[model samples]
Structures are given as C-alpha cells and as structure tokens.
Target: MRVVILCGGESSERDVSLASGRSVAGALLDRGHEVVLVDPAAAVPVLAGPLRPGDAIDGFAVGKEPPSPAARQQLRRRMHAALTGGPVLELLREAELVFLALHGGWGEDGHVQALLEMAGVRFTGAGSAACAAAWHKGRAQAVLGATGVPVAERVLWGPTANGVPEAVRRLLTAGPVVVKPVADGSSVSVHYVDSLPQLTQLAAEMRSGEVELMVEPFLSGREFTVAVVGDQVLPVVEIELTTSVFDYTSKYQPGAVSEVCPAPVPDAFAARLQELALRAHHALGFGGDAYSRTDFRCDASGEPRCIEVNALPGLTATSLLPRAATGADWSYPELIQRLMDLSTR
Candidate 1:
C-alpha cells in the first residue's frame, strides 16, 4: 500500500503532529508499505524519497509549550497557497490513503477533511462534520450529554459572552474548575483555577484573545482515556498526573505523567468507561475507520465523566492511543497496519 502521511501544518499542535508523522512513517515503512511523509505546509518536501528509518524520524520535537502564534502565522502564510494544488494534491491523488497526523487549527476542525472529500481522497479518522463536533469542546460536551453521557457543568466564556463573571461563578461554586480554550488540543492554555479572583483575572486575559474559552468543574477522582478503532474499543488508559492539571508540559515531557493501560479497574468500571467512550464516539457520528479517543475523568462521586473526543488523536511515541493498543496485544506496527486496513477498506 502507498501511504501519504500528512503532518506539520500551520497549527499550534504542529510539533505534536510532526512527531506523530515520524512515528507513523517509520512504522509503515517497517511494515513494508510504500510511504511518503510530507508536511503540507512545506514548499519543498521536508524529506524526499529513498526514505530511510532515520531520515523521516529525525527532527520534530514536542516542547513544553506549543509553537508560538507568530511562528504559526508565518507558516500559515507560506502554506495558504501550497495546499490548494501542485505536488501535495498530486501526492494525495496518487496515494492509497492520506493519513492525517495534523492536530488543531484547520487540520482538526474539518477543513482538511472537507478538502480531502472534495478531492475524492480517502483519509483516516472521522468525516468533516464529526471532526467539527469533536474539535469544539463545548459542542462535543453537548453531543455527549445529549446522548446520556455524563459531562461536567460548564460555562462558555468568550469575547462576545455576556455576564461571563456570573456564569463562571456558577461553575466555581461546584469547586475547582478547568479553564481552557474551547478549540485547542495537547492541553494548550489549559489551567486549573480554584478561586474566583484568579478565574476572573484569567478570564480577562483569555477574553482578550480571539478564541472562545470555557470553565468546567475539575473532576478529582482519576483520569482515563478510551479509543475507538473501526467499531472496536481498545483498552482503557489511566493518566496519573503529578500536577493537578495535565498541562502541555506534563503531557509531552517524560516522567511527569504515568499511564496505565487496561487501567487497573474492576471489569464493571472498565465496561462503563468503554461504553461511555463508544457512545461518545457514535454520538459524534464517527464510523468506518474513523478513530477517536474519548477522554475521561471521574468526579468526587467516583462516576466517570466525558471530557472531549479527539477525532484526530496524536500518534507520537508517548501518545495514549498507541499505549492502549499495546495493552490490547497489538504492536506499534500492528496498530498502524490495523488503521491502514480499516481506513482503506
């Protein structure tokens, strides 16, 4: 199979995406598949053919902070005219499938998926509308809640939001709350706030930005994630955080976070998490080879609550989905093959 893995776009998660791309490309190459790894934002190929293991795997690091906005803006400037035509499109049309390793920005928000659909190219992960639903934290929660999945009480705060302070106060009444951009991934700009004054100040700071933010009660029990791949639910992964918040730094850096796959839980509890994960996956309209990871955190009551579904999850060496796959007895290369089979079926 010929695979064109797209990565490193004009997104804040560009670093993460590039890491994922490297991992995916290496695995696919090992599996004896013809692989062409490309960063859509690059004018010339980031790496050309005669692809070797180290060539595609080199570079692309995940820092404690995401790429700066100014950096992303410059990349976007260079990318705007490149993605529409020429070699990138030719690669998309020539490959058996385009595996999107992109996260955040236009990549995860349905724009890239829509473009692929228009070009008659099949890509992995959910369709455009499902991607849109999963990209917005508020919308994902709404879809999950309506499907009877438990979700934390939240208040949306943005530039246009009125009575923001009072709404935030309502969430704070429940206890410490999580404040984050409604659209980001990899925990960028995500914070834990336990005081109204702090929350208010942070809100003001975030409000000054263009993206919408939201405040939701922080669940204290434990953190876990479940992945759905081609109608199958993989093992549960429990995230043990050294800090109260699993911010960008803790998530990407080593040792700060510990993940236990098939998360040491009673069968009943694992079943519950898997069910919630699957329901969230379906509620977001994901199917076929469209894979997703539904994040979970239990409340004080010990009941698991749905966080957000990641339609285009990270596939880096430290990514949660791959770890869960390992727990399910699938090797890294086997996981890639499984995704390829399901995605290109």
Candidate 2:
C-alpha cells in the first residue's frame, strides 16, 4: 500500500504531530508498505521512501508552551505560501490512503478531512462531519450527553459568545475549576484554576484573545482514556500527572507523568469505560470502524465521566492510543498496519 503520512500543520500541536508522523511512517515502512512522510503546512516531504533499520531520522521536539499569537500568524503566512507553492494536493491524490498524523488546527477540525473527501481520497480516522463535531469540546459533550453518556458540566465562552462573565460568576460561587481551550489536544492550554482571582485573570486573558475556552468544575478523581478502533474498544489508559494540570510538558516530556495501560481498575469499571468510550465515539458520528480516543475522569464517587473525543489521536510512541493497543496485545507496527488496513478497506 502507498501511504502518505500527513503531519506538522500550523496547529499548536505541530511538534507532537511531527513526532506521530515519524513513528507511523517508520512502522508502516517496517510492515513493507510504501510510506511518504510529508508536512503539509510546509508542503515538503520529510521522507521520499521507507526507512531502513538503524537509519537516523530528524526528530521534532515539543516545547512546554504553545506558539504565541505572533508566531502562529507567521506560521499561517508560511502555510499559505507552501500551499500555493507545493504539490500537496497532487501527492495526496496519488496515495492509496493518507494516514492523518496531523493534530489540532485545520487537521483535526474537519477542514482537511473535507478537502480529502472532496478529492475522493481515503484517509484514516473519522470523516469531516465527525471531526468537526468532536473538535468542539462543548458540542462533543452535548452530543455525548444527549446519547446518555456522562460528561462533566462545562461553561463555554469566547469572542462570539459572552459567557465568560457567567462562567466566572459560577466559579466564584462554586470553587476551583478546570480550564482549557475548546479545540486543542495533547492538553495544550489546559489549566487548573483555584480561586476567583485566578478565574477572573484567566477570563480577561481569554477575552483579549481570539480563542474559545471552556471551564468545568474540577472533578477530584483519576483520569483515564479509552481508544476505539474498528468497533472494538482497546484497553483503558490511566494518566498520572506530577503537576496540577496535564500541560504540554507533562504530556510530551519524559518523567513528567506516568501512564498505565489497561488502567488499574476493576473489570466492571474498565468495561464501563470501554462502553462509554464507544458510545461517545458513535454519538459524535464517528464511523464504527474508525479509530478515536475518548477521555474520561472519575469523580469522587469513582464513576467515569466523559471529557472529549479525539478523532485524529496522536500516534507517537508514548501516545495513549498506542499504549492501549499494546495492552491489547498489538505491537506498534501491528497497530499501524491494522489502522491502515481499515482505511483502505
């Protein structure tokens, strides 16, 4: 199979996407598939052919903070230049399937998927509609809640929506809360705010920006994630963070957190997690055969609560999906092969 692994967009998760692209491309190559690694934002191929064992590869590193507004503006300018200058569309059309190693921004938000759909190109993971539905945290939660899945109570605010003051008022009356960007992954811009002052400050910062943000009452419990692939639910993954929030560092940097696959929980509890994960996946209109990861958090009562569903989950070595796959007795290469086969089929 000829696989073109797309990665490194102008999204905040560009670094993580690059890492995922490298890992997926290498695994597909090992499985005897023809793989081309491309960074669509830059409109350049990182690799023209399959990788050989012991071959050194250029690696992308993740920073602790997301790119600033100015930097992101610059990235958009470069992206526009590349899209106009490079043959990205032609290359994508030629591939048997595109493994979407890209995350966040246009990649995960349904824009890229729409283009691929228009071109009649096969791609891994969910389709455009599903991606769009799941990319917005509030909308995803609403869909899941409507389908009988338990999701945390959240307050959404943004430029178009003037709910920030209400959110802050609620925080003042309640207590500490969890704040995060509405459409980001890898826990970028996720934070735990403790007091009214913090909430007010954060809200002010967001009001001055163009990003939509969501806040939910902090649930004091363990965090877990479940991966769904081809109608089957993989093992649950538990995240243990050393800090208050699972920020960029805790997510990508080594030793910043500890992850356990097939999370240490009772069979019934794990089964429930898997069930809800599948439900969330379907509720968001994701294909039953597509691959996605649904995050969850157990409240003080130990009941699982849905967070958000990721359509194009990261495929890096330490990514939760791969960890869950490993727990299900699938190697990295085998997992990559299975996802590719699903897309082609």
Candidate 3:
C-alpha cells in the first residue's frame, strides 16, 4: 500500500507527532509498504521514500510553556495554505491511505480529518465528527456521561471566571481539584491544586485567555488507560509517573515514568475498564473499526472514573496505545498494519 504519514503541525504537541510519524513510517516500510512522511507545517513531505530504524528524526523541542496565541494563529494560516496547494496535498489525495500520526491542534481536533474526507481520502483513526467530540474534553465527558458511563465530576469554565456555575464553585471548595486545557492533550497545562489560592490563580490565568480549563475533583488513586481498536478492547496499561502529575515531560520523555501493561488488577476491574473504554468510544460516534484510547482514575471505592478519550492517540515508540497492543502480543509492525487495515476497510 502507498501510505502518507501526516505528522508535525503547529500545535504544542508537534514534536510528539513528528516522533510518532517517524516511528510509524519505519514500521510500515519494514512491512514492505511504500511510505511518505509529511509535515504539512513544512509545506512538503520528506520525500525520502522510507525511514530506517537508525535514521535521524528531527523536530522542535517541547518546552514547559505553550505557543503564544499569535504564533499559533500564524502557523495555522501557513499550514492551511500548504495543505490546499502543492505536491503534499496531491500526494495525500493520491495515496492508498493516509496514516494520521498527528497529535494536537487542527490535526487531532477534526479540522484536518474533515478536509481529508472532503478530498475523498481515506485516513486512519476516527472520522471527523468523532474526532471533534473526543478533542473537546468537556464535550466528550458530557456525551459519555449521558450514556451512563462513570465520569469524574467536572466544571467547564470559559474565558471569564465570573460566569462559573455556583454549584461548580461549591464543588471546587470541597476538595483537591485538577485544572487543564479542555482542548489539549499530552497533559499540556494540567495542574493539581488543593488550595483556594491556587484555584484563584488558575482561574485568573483562564480569564486572561492563556487557557480555557475544566476543573475536576482530583481522584486519589491509580491511573489506567485502555485502548480500543475496531470493536476489540486491548489490555489495560497502568501509568506510574515520576511526578505527582503526568505532565508533558513525564509523558514524552523516556524514563520519566513506568508503564505496566495488562495492568496488575483483578480480572473484574480490568473488564470494567475495558467496557467503559468501549462505551466512551462508541458514545462519541467512533465506529467501523475506529481506534481510541480512554483514560481512567480509580476513585476511593475502587470504581474507575473516565477522564478523557483520545481519538488520535499517540503512536510514538513509547506511547501508551502501542504498549497496550504489545501487551496483547501484537508486534509494533503488526499494530500499525492493523490500523491501516481498519482505516482502509
């Protein structure tokens, strides 16, 4: 199959996306498929044919801070122009299938997926609507909650803090809470706060438009993620981060955390996690062999609470989804091929 692996974009997760694209390209090539790696941000594909395991992979360094709003807007415009005109777009339309190795920004938020669909191209992962629902954390949780899935108590706050619901404000005062960007992944701006002062500061930051956030009572227990491919749920992967929170560094950097697959939990508890993951996936309208990764944190009573769903889950060598697939005894190449087969089905 001729595949174009779309990777880096203007999002804060661009580096992560590039790494995933590089690793995926190498895997596909090893399986004897024609591959082209493209970074729409660069207005062209790598054109190097296929990457080898030992090849050098280059991308921007991820910092603790995110890109400024102005910078993001500029990059979006550049990427839009690049995608609409040139050989890269041509290749995407011509390819047998396009593997979406993208992580954040317009790439994972459904904008790019919609465009590809309009161009009559088949791509890996969920469709546009499902991607949109999964990209927005608050929306995804609402959809899942409506379906009777176990979701954490959360309050959505937009730019200004004045309009916050009184009930939500009360919930914030009762216990430790988590504040994070509703539209981002890779734990970009996630913060765990237990004090009034910290909540005030985070709210102020949100009002400044630095970030839009959702607050959820911090669940003090184990964290596990389950991956769903087509209708099959893979094994659970328990995340043990070095820090109190799984921030950007702990997620992408090696040795920052230890991930255990087939998470050493009771069979019943593992089955529950898998069931909730599939429920969340289908609730968001992801169907026909679509893939997703759902995160969970066990509550005090040992019940798992759904955190969020990642439609375009990372495919980096060390990403969670691949680890779960590996736990199910599927090799990395086989995993990539499975995704390709599902996308083209």
**Whole-model Cα lDDT of every candidate shown, in order:** 0.85, 0.82, 0.84
Q: How well does model 1 score by local distance difference test? A: 0.85
lDDT of 1 by residue, 1-345 (tens): 778888888888888888899888888888877778888786675454546444445646787778788888877876665567777788888888888888888889998899889999988878899999899999889878998999988878877875556878877887899999999888889999998788878877877767699888898889999999989999999999889877788877768799999899999999999999998988998986689999988988898888889988889889899999999999999988888787766
Count clashing pairs, candidate 1: 0
Candidate 2 global TM-score: 0.93
- Which number leads on lDDT? 1
Compared with the true structure, the alpha-carbon lDDT of candidate 3 equals: 0.84
| lDDT at position 127, candidate 1 | 86
User: Residue 93 in candidate 1 has what lDDT?
Assistant: 88
Candidate 3: residue 87 lDDT (0-100): 73
Candidate 1: regions farther than 4 A off: 43-45, 50-56
Which candidate gets the maximum TM-score versus the true structure? 1
User: Judged by TM-score relative to the true structure, which candidate is superior, 1 or 2?
Assistant: 1
* Clashing residue pairs, backbone N/CA/C < 3 A, model 3: none
Model 2 over residues 213-244: C-alpha lDDT tens digits?
88888778899999999898999899986676
How should the candidates be ordered by lDDT, best one leading?
A: 1, 3, 2
lDDT head-to-head 1 vs 2, winner:
1
